[model samples]
Target: EAGVVQSPRYKIIEKKQPVAFWCNPISGHNTLYWYRQNLGQGPELLIRYENEEAVDDSQLPKDRFSAERLKGVDSTLKIQPAELGDSAVYLCASSFGRGRSNNEQFFGPGTRLTVL
Candidate 1:
């Protein structure tokens, strides 16, 4: 099966500008996730999806960030009025199951969004 895929791989925008990123999870995977990676840091969960349901999203920055998994398949994450501090890699990951023993997720290369 194909692995997760992301677009642009990189982006640059000014503060207060709008930016959007796209993601496609692995085939047959029922769980998808979006994570934020700050420089020199591990990925932090932003949101998670179990098919069409958002099973976890407590860490999303509601003030300027938003995300959705349309049709429970492909997902998109957007940041309206981006801030300079938002500059980081936005990673998309997917997993075969949500069970504790099957929790390892496959990750995309990520979209490096830089708000200048």
Candidate 2:
């Protein structure tokens, strides 16, 4: 089955540089999510969107991270002045809706970023 698709499976950049990751969700899915996973930790939610509106982004670092979902299909996550601590796997996920019973999300392969 076709699932969420993400580009640039890996990225390497300087600490102060900027980086971006893209994601394309499954057809007809209306909710999307961005997550960050460190070396030994589980994926942490960075942002969540219901269509084009960001319904949950409290965990996102507003000073350095920004995300957008255009036309509610494809989404992009960007990080400016990427810090060494920002080196992690960026994951993208999508689901049919945000209801409690319909929250099962399909995840992408993820973009692994390495900041030096």
Question: Which candidate number maximizes lDDT?
Answer: 2
Residue-level lDDT tens digits of model 1 in 5-41: 9997999999999999999999988899999999999
Model 1 bad stretches (over 4 Å):
99-102
Models 1 onward score TM values of: 0.94, 0.95
User: Which runs in model 2 stand beyond 4 Å of their true positions?
Assistant: 100-102
Give the Cα error of residue 3 in candidate 2, in Å: 1.2
Candidate 2 lDDT: 0.93
For 1-116, candidate 2 gives per-residue lDDT tens digits of: 78899999999999999999999998898999999999999999999989998999999999999999978889999999899999999999999977452678899999999999
Worst 10 residues of 1 by lDDT: 95-104
- Please list the C-alpha lDDT of all candidates, in the order they appear: 0.91, 0.93
lDDT of 1 at 69: 85
Candidate 2 local Cα displacement, residue 37, angstroms: 0.4
